[model samples]
Target: MPKQDNLSGYNNTGSDTSVFFLSGIPGLEAMHLWISIPFSSVFTVALLGNCTLLYVIKTEPALHKPMYYFLTMLAVINLVLSATTVPKSLSIFWFNFREISFTACLVQMFFLHTFSSMESCVLVAMAFDRYVAICNPLRYVTILTNSVIAKIGLAALARAVLLTAPVLFLLRRLPFCQSHVIAHCYCEHMAVVKLACASTSLNNIYGIFITLFIGGLDLTLISLSYVRILRTVFSLASKEEQLKAFSTCFSHFCAILMTYTPMVLTTIIHRFGHQVAPHVHILMANFYFLLPPMMNPIVYGVKTKEIRDRVLLLSHGKNF
Candidate 1:
């Protein structure tokens, strides 16, 4: 269970204070309790998986490199992203507590998109790491130095902040005079903005811009990196060398799909899918937030040899 909880203690919806009522899965309110079973379980698994990944990355000295450091950033971002949205959703489902203050919802929107963008930026960094390792092996270390990675991390945060901070001011200007009941669970950008009475042309424009900027640009860069990586791998003299080169990228490619596909689909569907049911949109939103967090470690562990070996050693009570 994660999401827009009493985080920062912003849940007082008094008669005077403006608050948003979250209608958890509009059409399936009756099934909330039942649905929360999987939600809570997935949340638990996501936290455990990411924590375990962090622990493994920390303890294994052999895993200390740019690739793993980018992975570490991804893991932390996954943890925060899941923490931002799932628990509150589960709370709403299980206990029928779906009230969230406007301030709290704003905080939720900020962090939700911030970490999501961070995840995207981290993926791009990972793509670049793979690119250098595959396409420019000799210069990999010099290109992805520790200080450089630190700069990349900071740059990611700065970019996310630059894009998402404006959302707060834009939201503050719009007046929610009609119903405060948001059809979905958390305070998603478009979802919250849709409840506004004023013109949301600016908000819509910004939302679309953020989606394309983060998802579109990052996807293009990653795709270019992989395309070059594949061309480099194919040029290797031996079949074994080609396989080895491609194997290194399998986990990262899976991560790219896990993260971008759902996010892009959700944003597109939200913008254009008028015929879709409310619960369907909400479920897709939940999946967008939850899937990557839960599956990332498993994908990495199973696909990448080092993490898998370290995890197995720890599981088997052996020195890692």
Candidate 2:
């Protein structure tokens, strides 16, 4: 149960708490239609691209390897992340429906953060898969078997839930005496926490701690895995073999860069960029959530010959 704060002056009690107003973009009310155009287009492409990636992986037997399996998991996480935030964002833009119920807001916050964290974990797992394939080819299959892949996916989800569940509890305890208008598009953790009249030091501390430890630790492991992979690739006698092995990791590396760069910049902006305009923060937050999902499929489809050929085959009315 949440520890309710004193509400003597505020008109609303616990039962009377109402919806929160999600401001889509702080100062661009008139240009919402224009904004919706690009946002809707990106959402559509992300949906189609990720869904197609999943379908190709499912029907193509050649893509049943561990790397593709991790790719499938990545696609699913991207879908969830985009689905949870984009529709509501579009609704806010198109229909001016910006009111999110308090409970629903919390649910959205939970799922968005959960899947984002899961995506990070999946990327780390994919890095490990690449490392094994390049540096220890003899044991790749034995190491990342079907059962082990399942366990990795499960662990990713479990880690996300464990880290995000406390945020909902913490939000519930805070007394929202200030205006309920959120300055961003969605229910971001810090955005919502900032609205609370009560002390938010614990929430801020925990959020930063989880972000640094989970995200930082995952990134460190991925970097180390790639370092080993590159070292092994360089040791190969033939230049062709080195290029072939490194090519396999290029798409995943791009995906990581897309994911973490925006995330790191947005975190820095939020914590330190006090003089920055409100709309800038909102736009950066949107990029942090939107860009990776919109680009991941395109990256893999263009970079991976197997997926590209399968997609081309499907497009030409041939068997995948």
Candidate 1 local accuracy as lDDT?
0.86
What is the per-residue lDDT of model 2 for residues 1-320, given as tens digits with 9 covering 90 to 100? Answer: 11112212332334456667777787787787899998889989999999999999999899999999999999998898889998999888887777788999988998988998998999999999999999999998899999999999999999999998998898899988757777778998898888888889999999999889888899999999999998999999999998898788889999999999888888899999999898888888888667888899999999988899999999999993
Clashes per candidate (backbone, < 3 Å): 10, 0
Model 1 lDDT tens row, 47-145: 999999999999999999999999999999999999999988987987778778888998998999898889999999999999999999999989999
Alpha carbon deviation, residue 311, candidate 1 (Å): 1.2
lDDT of each: 0.86, 0.87
Model 2 has a clash total of 0
**After TM-score superposition, what is the CA distance of residue 222 in candidate 2 from its true location, in Å?**
0.5
Name the 10 consecutive residues with the lowest summed lDDT in model 2.
1-10
Tell me how far the alpha carbon of residue 156 in candidate 2 is from the true structure, in angstroms, after superposition. 0.6
lDDT of 2 at 161: 94
Candidate 2, residue 319: Cα displacement in angstroms equals 1.7
TM-score of each: 0.94, 0.94
